[model samples]
Target: MSEQEFTKSLTYAPGLPKDATFYSGHKKRVTSHAVSEAAENALKERGVAVEDIAEIVFDLQTPFMAGLTMEACVENVRGALAKRELQHAILVGIELDKLAEKKMLSEPLQSLVDQDEGLFGVDETIALGAVSSFGSIAATTFGYLDKVKPKIIGRLDQEKHGKVNTFLDDIVCSIAADASSRLAHRVRDQEERRLPKKR
Candidate 1:
């Protein structure tokens, strides 16, 4: 197949008309390249490296997904980052975190976000929306990451990071969770394809 045909095949989903125009302009801007660039820039601005984020994702996913390579895990993270909804979530979450860091919000809300108040969980809730796209496994993985705060995630949450990462941390966790779920699905598909056909 031609490259254009391959690209079209990948993007076409059942029940969604290929010619349907939805957010034509915005969707054009939401390409995989754009999403990856946005994710990288957001991480860099927060004093976190993409490598560190990828490493955390690798560590979080490899244990559950046997035979999954670090490279594959990293690629899955990139794929997760490519989703337009996920890109939007990352941008919104980081903007909220920065606003909270600067105390730009008003009244009790400002105080709640700045202090990382336990009861104030709107940040996580926003991040959770991104996790739902990949199904229940993504949600469970996110819950695990939230509770464990492993590796780079723990560091990002520290006061020494010089910023409130209340939203960013959850956003990262959701990314990793989504990536893990994606990898699991891909692996299962491969395995099923390899099974012997019924006579």
Candidate 2:
């Protein structure tokens, strides 16, 4: 059915469409490329660029992965964000941060998110959730980046532009961590390919 038709069918149920059992995206699956574009756009809107995240990945992996170019790092960063988990995490975190910026969130909860209280660990938790699929390397790198807040992350966390970046900074860190981990795995694959075949 057409999008308009499907949308009009919402009256079948009080709040949901007639057939909520199916995946809405099945007709036009949300492609990785689409997600990549959206994720990058979201970051760009918030003054963060794909290169900003790529720089972190390069810094984290250059010592271990020789001949690693900035272009390669950037591609890997894009590749990582293409995954639904990273896309969702970054989008959700950024939205929350924007909400806090507008002071649209409720009290107490709003204060916690806006102030970025030291005790508030939910930001890191959301970031870790995005990095979890990448394995121990991403997890550890996320922790390291959280502590250092290198590059754009540092600026984001410290900048006071009426914007609350409690979740955004961590989300960026997780993307870098995940990209670094993906680069590492790709390097491993390249090494295995070069090795002599076992008899």
After TM-score superposition, what is the CA distance of residue 83 in candidate 2 from its true location, in Å? 0.6
Residue by residue across 1-199, what tens digits does model 2's lDDT show?
5555443322334667545534344356577777777888999999998899999998999899879999999999988887888998988899999999999999987999999999999999999999999999999999999999999999999989687899999999999999999999998999999999999
In angstroms, what RMSD does candidate 1 have relative to the true structure?
7.2
Candidate 2 lDDT for residue 137: 95
Candidate 2, position 32, lDDT: 72
Give per-residue CA lDDT, model 1, range 1-199, as digits (tens): 3334333433345687767423332234446777668777987888766566677767866777777677887788888888877888888888877987787889888788777789988878987999999999999989999989887788777754448888888888888889888988988899999999999
Candidate 2 similarity to native, TM-score: 0.84
